[model samples]
Target: MTWRWLLLLISLTACQGPDQGDPYRPYLRVADKDDVPTLDPARGYDTASWQFEDLIFETLVDYNDEGQIIGELAQQWKAEANGTRFVFRLRDDAMFSHGRQVTAEDVRFAITRVLAPETGSPGRDFFLSVRGARTCDKPGCEVAGLVTLDNKTLVVEVEQPDPLFLHKMALPFASAVPPEIIVREGENFDFRPVGTGPFLLAERVAGQRLVLKPNPYYRGAVQPRLPGIVRFVGVPEDLAWMRYRAGLLDLAIIPPAEIPIVLRDPKLSRLLRTADTLRTQYVGLNCARPPFTDVRVRQAMNYAIDRRKLIAILHHRASPPQGIVPPTMPGYPQRPEPYPFDPPRALKLLQAAGLGGGFQATLWLRNDETAIRVAQSLQQDWERVGVRVRLKPVAWGPFLDAVRHNPNIDMFLLGWEADFPDPSNFLEVLFHSRQIGANNHTYYSNPVVDALLEQAASTTEPAQRTELYLLAEQRILDDAPWVLLYHPRTMLLSSDRLRGLRLHAWRPPRLAQLWFAEEKTEE
Candidate 1:
């Protein structure tokens, strides 16, 4: 059968249930293209895993609807010693789903586990600023910065004052896990995670489905309204959309190609939700290699592409970025397009850089439908400016590995979603000379930019910090380490029966707040 017919058949079958049950059942059904690889907070780094982790685990702090940091497991926290030392008081009522009271020691264990060399967690680098974190590479070595001051309080000390430390604590990597469970389950702890969150994993089928039930032990102010959450994993976007139309899924991510079609349909448009996310999609130009090594060549490449046209291709779901930082981020300066499309100017700059004769380079990208389309658009645009482009598409997991490790990478298409709503998260993490093999995939380095980033990160005053970040951003833009593309808007179609569902800029969806609205019957 053809693809359309197959979807139609599935929809027809889905509608033929024997009993017309309540449409507002207290169970959410959602679909995603990826599966959560592991539930262990220390190991899982990708969004797919983090989404599930947000439901199953609780961090010391969390972002409210307004994106402000608020207490979660910790009732309150205070920063002292010029922001280098932090003291947190655990919520007296906080208890794990398995009925154990959450203690400060649990918090210390979670942080130190991520720092342990044996754990090999991706979050290790995120805590390198913690005192003794740099040298605590051995298995038994404790992080001297992390101290448990009684069962109710925890004290943390960093090597330097970091204004964003509380924000980092809100991340899933810092989620508190029961140490006894880890000791008992060992390697199996990843599959059987227990934490202090609103939901507890009840069922799991590899590459298929996961079921979560509300935790009775959860003592947070916001109780889960939904009795359970059912996530269908490893489902493609197209199939998920079909399932959504079939009434099998309460939420589905609208595929890039289907976005325009859904927007045009009056009925479907009512269900569409778009949120401007704190994300930047860009092409990393390898500044350490030839061609892009020259600032003029990098600037010319940035000017070659028509960002407006690219946004159009994305069905106006994105806004052209002015610089590396997304406009949604604080400290993002209001400015005109730095490199507006100018074919003549692009060629002139290339000529001035002594590269008037076209040079060939490979552009790596994830083998996704939307990424492929964007890469092709870039390929055509650069070809007009004497830059011959070869597109190399790899799967998502391997693509990240290649970009981070492969020295031969000339250019790559990637998107960075903010871990926190801080300018330093974008500026320092992506451009700093210190992050060269880490998040700085471009290998772009400038001593002045590095100093500015350091000054911005340490500055506690908001205005002064923003000014430093702006100076660093301006310098980086002139260097043109990346072809700043656009900030994408997250588009998802929600069932009319669902209520209180909203997209967050940086964090996962607030599942606890969501519920199914009561079905209305004709009077």
Candidate 2:
């Protein structure tokens, strides 16, 4: 058996003890993102970030508590002619939160609008790498391949046949949105979501909280066992701990800063820490631009970092990241060795790049305290090598805008997490020259790297795909566009009563399948 399955089997054995054992509990108050701009799937970034969103609207496919994609809205699915084309057979009983039946047409409309630029959707970045996506971007555009043949059958054609297509369908952007709400309403759809997922939005207060209640109109009784409500409290990770301690919250995702204190309490025995393989924190080099244009300059910077110290800052719980994909992920070429903290080597390389004398470079960072800390560390580290660094700090939202949409820095700090477990999800989207949008601040690309990713995406065979990914991963490690730092670990602190909680591929805190003890409920 593969390592993924092996880990899953061992991890899940604990939750499967006895069916009649514990009753699943309902409400969970948790830390949340800054905002979910709209409920319209096409236009929103964090719209579906909260667990409440997951219940209110679901993708055609969804991850179980373990982070593996299980059929959610698409009860049964099949791809035709050797996985080149896909035909999802929808559950006949599936219906939107509104009384309308969910037809194949709704899925097609939702996906097509994502490729439509004028919708003002950030999800556009997610699909640009999709096959046949170019046609949608043309002046008089049309997304050629998607079709709804009947009420239940949805067929999609791709320019290049990709085996990962079905898995990609399981991502948030591919989640089914109501054709009537997302399309007809546009901006107005944020207040009202028309979906076929597990829950419905009850009420939302800006800058404070967002609440979701179980959708009564949902069909089929096979659903999340805990069915009351999921609320996301928009507060810093520090405050989230206090809420959890006060019994006002059941779970809180431990951010880097909070790991130290969260681990201190003997009360956090239920704390679960897992490799969040999705995001990789690193310093990005603008290969074609500015002071970072020289490869030696990039390498010099690499020699100056201390991954051990970075992990120490994160409280030593997270796996010091080896590469973009962890060793747990398939096709790891090799564990990424830690860069030597050699200021002399860094200085020599800088000299080789004709930058021996100190040159001023901007260290762009978001306004978060953590980002500021990381920036401060690098600022001091490189200063020893005669690289004077000016810190460019901006608030999180505008910070992303400056990094992605417009190029404004010599070196930029960033993080990347996989939407799916696939290597193509890591290599193709960020590194593929084709996908360098406002989101891809790094313009680095190579034809060989692109070819390997294309080969991997073209075939469905896991072995062949793994081989291609391994080769591709090695290429990037050598290229070194970004220094691979430690993999962030997510620590979940909840009561012992919180059973069957799973932090899946995206680190989305799923409240489904959890049970409250009968003993605890009475107390």
Candidate 3:
């Protein structure tokens, strides 16, 4: 037999008891963006923050690999009164990292914190269905929709019937936090989080790195497979890939420029993995501004750009625009192509809008390498039809503020990934007038579209709700507030030694299921 087989045989022979064997593998390594903005679940709106929060926190419900809703903290939930009310039963053995049994009161306090104005949670809008949710700004404000019956049972009531509320519960924003700990630690509790997850935050080095270890009191059915995980940050994307090549990181993200080189290499190509992401990139116009206020000008801009060319140059894995709503989404409408690459037609439309001489405008974008390529491509495409464009690249936070507050910015390039798998999450949240100065950066508003979205949310029947959503999507497409670009596929590079690395479409990868192939399997 081979030496590897001999070692395995000896290990098996040396096993003296059922509780003893080779010790569990100790470490896992991965790469992330420059920094994690925040570890606080309530204020985590960015991807990096959500990634860390997802690993260290547990929500009431979660999505499985096939995108179906599954129970996490709660053992099971029952819907009654035509989906108006939901009753959840906590698992008897659930325990927080501090070794306290998780109770229903903890759930109530966690949600009340999100509702409090002091928390400043961007996800507060998601829970408006609860009675008195709109007016309550402080804890103990008598929310009629929330009630904890005993130590293990809780009830939630909504004003209208909503079948999608369960899906919303699976978001990271709904993850439970230790109420007593927060009360004692105050705002500092955000950085020092405590949750009932498989892993706990063991150490952090400001902007440099973060380390997590298996939770001793974890109550989940599956414990963390590795003893510990180390996440490195602030490393440039190219340099991170180099680290991956040298076996420093088990996982790394492949940048757009290096995709070709990686694919050409025989050894590197075997380790490539790809998944379709539920994300959409677009160039949003300021609908309230002077030139873009005209629908003809908006249509002209969309028609001038060559979308397929952009995809070929920067992203071979991206699919061309079907609509602002990704095609994979339920209830997506089949609509006619309102704008294709027609420079002459674009010129005519601009002339009709009384801009025959063309107009000067600025496009705002982030200062990332990929964003720069996208901005340059758009400039070239628009200049072909007489529109002069200037590119302004800014940092991420300042760019978000400028898009929301600066009225002079003619257009901006950005992208939105779905928080939940629903049509309302995309169509209504982004185009609804109520969201202006928020995610609706375009200031897009149409009374007809508004009514359709509201009706869809209130409707109980799935077929009827789908029709209403389709109508709203069509109306927004006709308005052309955003020149929808493409849906990107997620590409990840990892060491071949790593196994069971599955992707979650709406969130980050789950770390509990991953293990090194060389390690002996857990019982």
Q: Which candidate is the best by TM-score?
A: 1
- Candidate 2's displacement at residue 165, Å, is 1.3
- Per-candidate clashes, comma-separated: 0, 12, 0
The 10-residue segment with the lowest total lDDT in model 2? 16-25
TM-score of each: 0.89, 0.84, 0.88
Best first by TM-score, ranked? 1, 3, 2
lDDT of 1 by residue, 213-288 (tens): 9999998978888889888767666676776777777888777778878988999999887788889999999999
The positional error of residue 438 in candidate 2, measured at the CA in angstroms, is: 5.3
* Cα lDDT, model 1, residue 518: 76
Which candidate tops lDDT? 1
> Candidate 3: lDDT of 146?
84
Q: Which stretches of candidate 3 lie over 4 Å from their true place?
A: 1-26, 331-338, 397-409, 519-523
Which 10-residue window in model 1 sums to the lowest lDDT? 16-25
Over 185-300, each residue of candidate 2 has an lDDT whose tens digit, in order, gives 65667777778877777777776666666667777545755546545545545555544554556676665766666567666754554645466678887777867777788878
Candidate 1 residue spans exceeding 4 A from truth = 1-26, 138-140, 183-188, 203-206, 264-266, 352-355, 520-523
